[model samples]
Target chain A: MEQIGLSHIAITTGILLILTGLWGILTQKNIIKMIIGFSLFDTGIHIVMVGVGYVEGKTAPILDEAVQLKEAARQIVDPLPQAMVLTAIVIGIGITALMLAYALRLYQKNKTLDIQKFNDLKW
Target chain B: MIIKIIAIIIGLAILLMALIAVYNKKLIVAIVAAGVVSLFASVMYLLLSAPDVAMTEAAIGSGLSTIIFFYVVNKIRKNRKDHA
Candidate 1:
């Protein structure tokens, strides 16, 4: 693994985001906060994947004869993460929407957003 | 080096926002802080060169979620007042 500089930074940030998410989940009393924590955790992992694909001193994948397109392609950032992130993005949206719908239903039934006040599901 | 510094700042911002969301007395402030953290995370995603993830984070993570939470909060508040 050729790790240095920016890559190290990316890795550290990813770890930090995960830690923050964990803290949020553990400490927050509200359902919405938990959702936010989950999202943040998801985003952090996605960022780490993107960072893993980074190529030092590489331009984005764009074809142009004016520049050294072939050379650039040789050192180009990984396209797999780009593609994967697209999939993740859509999945995140779907999940968030579904979670919000559930939250709404929970609120409607309980009349409270506080998770502590919600004990009907706890059996 | 600069990018790493930026990433560290973004991470700190995320931590700060998460704290605010967890500890803020006002529900609205917490909600807004969550939105800000999502927005900051999206910016970090862009910095890490994930534009697609950044866009989705901005839209779904910050936008739709915040609005939904606000609506839910408003409903809860109104219902409580109705009982009082």
Candidate 2:
């Protein structure tokens, strides 16, 4: 059997987190719970993105006195995914905030947070 | 070597908290559990050699997002009490 590594552990956690989020999103009747599920989903995706960029024994992308400039590329893990995850984290929070605000507005409109009651598109 | 074990432990903790966030009966408890998941995930990112991502997840995911969720929850509660 292959020994588990950091990437393996991280990606596994990400996948499980995504599954948990999906379960919550599907089974919960409350809008707030659904929003929390979405947040979980976003976090899972971020974790997976960062995990995929890991090198076996490399350091982080940031350069410091410990890392030589000429050998930086060989010494550091992939930076593109890290940069992408940075943007994703910010966007995830923005999306979460927007979702919460929309849920509040929906509750205001009907005074109910139940998913089944807002079935305007049910035909 | 030992870092791998630590990573595994943290991963399990994150998964457990995520399950709690999904399956808990109390809304506030669920929200706090989700915040814990984010914090643990930031640690996972650090282990994966993504410090920048780790910092961002810590600050934005666990910090600001939890506050916003709590704010919205409080607002909803106030709305319910106002009507009741």
Instruction: Say which candidate scores most in DockQ.
Output: 2
Candidate 1 per-residue lDDT, tens place, A8-40, comes to 667667777777778877888888778777766
Please tell me how candidate 2 rates in CAPRI terms.
high
Q: Measured against the native two-chain assembly using Cα atoms, what DockQ does each of the candidate structures obtain, in the order listed? A: 0.52, 0.90
Off by over 4 Å in 1: A1-4, A64-67, A121-123
B-chain TM-score, every candidate? 0.94, 0.96
Best by lDDT: 2
Model 2, span B1-84: residue lDDT tens: 888889889999999999899989889999999999999999999899888888998998899999999999999999889999
Candidate 1: give the clashing pairs. Answer: none
lDDT of 2 at A76: 93
lDDT of 2: 0.91
